[model samples]
Target chain A: MDAPTEHLPNVAEALARAVDTRASRERDLLGELEALGAERERLRVAILSLEAQRAALDPIEAEVRAELTSLDDGAHEVLFNSLIAQRAAVAARAELVAEAARAQRDAARETTDNIDALLVEYRQFRDVIEPTLPDLPATYRSVLKAHHDGVVSRLRQFFSRVGADPVPLDAPALDLDVVIGVDGDGAEAVGVTIAIPVSGDVRAATLEGAPELELTLAARVVQAIYEGLDAIGQPTAVTAFGDHRGLLVVEVEVEPTDRADLVDQLLGIMEDVLGTSAELLAAGVRVRALEVPADHLFPPEESSDTLEDAS
Target chain B: MSEVAPEELIVVPLAVAAERLQIDPFEFMRLLVMMGEVPATLQISEALIDRVRAAAGIELWWAEDVLLPTDASPSRAIVRAALRQLLERGFVGARATRIDNLWRGRPEDEALLRRAVSLLHREGMVGMSRSRAGVVVSVSPAAVPQLDAAVRGESMPAALAALA
Candidate 1:
């Protein structure tokens, strides 16, 4: 009794019991776990049902939120359409205003252009242009155009006899474009112009298309005009020569005390020329006088055809 | 002595040489001219002048100094002076300008010189080569003997016959 020989005192049975107890506890725990799982499953199913409900209501709530955030029927969009139509109308009016502005600008430009033209013309007037003109009065000297022909020598003699001291051309042999005025001091004259058709052709130096003898007669006609200037003695004549289109032109200046007597003097001179240059007229040399003033200023009319017929 | 003939030789006027030597050309030429006719051609060269200068046994019969006549007209005096210049400078030839300027201190003197030169030219004493600028006056080679004789105080029929 004191010490039992077998030490295995019901340990298997106790282990079996403990095992049964643990199995029972395990079964209970399993059952409780199953219960908890069922409860969790029910909770998950309820949560899914609530989630389904929330999913079902989300679109309606979203519709309400959107309704609060924005307008219904979009009246402001109608306002945008109206603004677009108003923009079109403003553009058309601006186009019309722009057209008017362009027209006004064009008109202003034309007016300015005319004003500028008038200013230029005014600047070109004699009052403005006269100061710049040379103070050199006409001289009783000959202004030879280029090279005068040999007839110039004879003409020079004739001019000298008629009180026209013709200045000699320095290089009469040159064929230049220069019109040389040679003066032996005190040759300048403040007198009236007596333009001479010094040359029948424009070329004085070459006497183009003019015979020497014919040229002699033409120059003599110029000399014959002075016979009628009986009282205008000792008046120096300044001779200027030029070439018009196919015609020789010369201008001379003479002084007269009375401008009123110029018409009579010119008429007398014309008569004298017509009488004196009868040979020239007979030779069919168109000895018509032009650029002569009648009283104030005479027009260059072609009336001297009678002289040719008379000849 | 030159092998070159007188014509081939460079002809320098005796006046040029006399002007260089500052001696009477006519007077010295007399020393060279012999009794014969003046050679048809004479060479005027530096060698000949040197020889003439160095030569010995040469008789030069030149005019002695004499007084100008109290009654000597200006033209006559000009003629005498031209002759003297001709002799003194051996001036056998000169441009007319030179003869003209020679006595042309005054206008009258120039006229006188021109008249004298013309007189000499007309007398056949001088030959002239006319040009646009002026005439050239040269002593006639044939007249050299007579000019020399006149220089030696011989009576000449020319206007300047009494040159000496």
Candidate 2:
């Protein structure tokens, strides 16, 4: 079990390297501890000095009372009265200093507590972000875009199935507008807007004493659209507008980007709406088309016929 | 001593009932005449009947044939005609011979009449009473005195005037 002489230098080198690394870390830790200890000691000394000064006020007030009792002549009494006033001022100032010191100590303790809590939170945040940090920017953007696209595609599918024919074949039948932005944490944020064009027969009934059938039909169509959107399980903010003619404009906004299968889910919703539409038509609600406007796919600023402004 | 229960009755005004049936008061009186087993009648003064015969230059035996002042009032005339017909038909009784200002019809027609009377009551044109027997329809007590005064050929009473 004699020492392997050939491996001695390598062992020694390894030992020296471990010692050097340990020593460097120890020095850094010791430096930080020393700085913290110095700060604590300085605060302790300050508080102690204030306490001593406050304690001295009692003895000083006793001496003032002794001096007041010794005063016999009127002039001496006046001077002793002035001395008492000065003593009272000093006592008041000492009380103020003690209060300030106590406040500082409490603040320091609160700061220390906050720092401990913040350190835990910071570690958790780092753990969460560390693995994704390298590819976060690109991945975030792509995910945001995919979510926006999914919503738009689902909405388009929904409109295609529900909307009447003469559906614009080459262009987007409905407007699917998305706004993408970077958040404070560099995560991509997205907003989606879909505009659906609603058209129906606005012709006034020629029969005398007939009710306002067009307006009634428009209201029914808008209600059906709202119900259909709700049934589809998509969180959309819907707004409806009537042009006073036969056209109703419905704008739906999908703000949340969490659902990945938004389009497919909406197509499933259309199946339910088709049954509802058949019943509605039988009830004399004659809405011909509830399609998305072809031009709405482009940015709202570029489109001349923005349903948002029309509403 | 036994405690007597308060009488509850459903009464509709004749005018109100006529309006509900979409008919004139005279036409309503005729329908009542047709429906009743015993027709309503009013007593005529023999002196008045005789005076009408003399004015018409009719023989004393033909006094009954002469048109009486009852002819001027369709309400009074219909009651007389119905009573005469009932007498000729051999229905003899004081109740059968007398006509009431209020008209009541067959029991089978009660439901239809009650609905019509209820409509008039809802309109505040008549008062009603309901009993175990059935509904009793009549003009409001406030208007009864006025109707009596009209039947007597006198000015409406002060109490009824105040109501008006």
Candidate 3:
């Protein structure tokens, strides 16, 4: 006889609970996929309707053109002169028809493009979720930890590549502090602060003489970093400090839990961001001695001590 | 019947009058004789003559002459005839005066000097000094070089004759 449900081991109950949760999520995703399919069909019909509307104007336009040409050729000048008012009316109507046709064609093209993008997105979502949905609830904790680790690793790689020292992060336990919820509600966040020493040339100039040039360079650097983070679906807050003792500090704080796989994508995004810096460096704005601050390296309780020790 | 006082009659210095007409004082007196209008000559006050002479920077004291008496003044018809003769023979135009100096001209010559002053004032070449003696005038300092250039050579003689 099968074991009684009440007497089943706690581990077995947990396994069963995970399986049920996965099944429920899979069902929800399938429903969403079905809705998306319907939406795609509706879009396809909308595009066809617009195309047909555009085609319908073509015959009327052609008829107007024929009449205009007949008037131009002077095949029936007496009749044409008699219908001069009608000819003008027809010309105006033709122009309006042509305009409507162009508008319709443009609408149809735009709708088709939007539908294509939706389809691509739906397919990608389907591919990702189909194989993983069953195992997601089971590996949820480990996955979250892996994601965090991956983000930190990518950040370290980014710092190393950019000649910056990574500030050691002493974040709380991943399970307790960083929650990667199913509905994308979580506190999984990472903050990276890098100090880029202002080059001798940039530091030599007074801010009063060429303010915009210096500020714009600093702004561009920050914008490049922000763009990189945004592209990877990592919501980031960026702050850039003016040269303090010849150091230009940029702080980037990212919420990795906002999207899945964002941590894995961070390195590539940061590389792109660093590409702009590389260009800036090539243009004679050298940024060196890139490092994270002691405060960022230690927990709040130990941060002061760490800083003092470093000093 | 009317009686005229000598002081009431307009008397001018001969040196100033000759300078106004741009002719030598003795030459002008000779011209008056040739016109059959020989003027009665009278000496101007020494102080007045010296003041005008010094102001005008005229060192040729011998060039100074007696004023032609108004009682024996030449008629306009005779003066006009003399001017025509002078122009036919050619004469220099009037010289510009200093600011502190007074103008002296015979009745017929007064109109010509007045017109010359008006032209200089209109051309912004002279500044006017209002006085009971009449509107005393002088060439502007800036216009001195221009006046000098205008008077160079025999150019003034022809220009003055044209004015006549």
Whose TM-score is greatest here? 1
lDDT of 2 by residue, A1-311 (tens): 98776644687889999999999999999999999999999989998998999898989998999888764345323432433343233233323433443454355445344433443444343456445656679878577556544443433333233222111122212121111111122122222232222232221221121222222233333333334334444323333232312233334444344333333333343334333433223322222232222232333234344343211
Tell me the tens digit of each residue's lDDT in model 3 across A1-311: 98677764699889999999999999999999999999999999999999999999999999999888644333223322323333233233323433443454355445344433443444443456446656667677566546544443433332223221111222221110000112222366555543332221232232222222232233334443444455654422332233322334444445645443443343343344334443233222322222222243222233222110000
* Distance from true location, Cα of A291 in model 1, Å: 5.8
lDDT of 3 at A62: 99
Candidate 1 DockQ score? Answer: 0.01
For each candidate, C-alpha RMSD in Å?
45.2, 45.8, 52.8
lDDT per residue (tens digit) for residues A1-311 in model 1: 57767756597899899999999999999999999999999999999999999999999999999878754444323433433343233233323433443454355455344433433343343245335435434331122211222222322332223211111222212110101111112234333323232332412322222222223333343343333233355222333433332223334355534444543565455555544433233222333333322221211232231110000
DockQ of each: 0.01, 0.01, 0.00
- TM-score of each predicted structure versus truth: 0.20, 0.19, 0.19
* Model 1, global lDDT: 0.40
Error of 1 at B109 (Å): 33
For residue A50, model 2's alpha carbon misses the true position, in angstroms, by: 94
True contacts recovered per prediction: 0.00, 0.00, 0.00
Worst 10 residues of 3 chain A by lDDT: A173-182
Per-residue lDDT of candidate 1, residues B1-164 (tens digit): 23432222323334444333333333224324321112222224544554554441122222244333332354554455455555555546552223433443333455555666676678888766532222345576666777666444454436653332
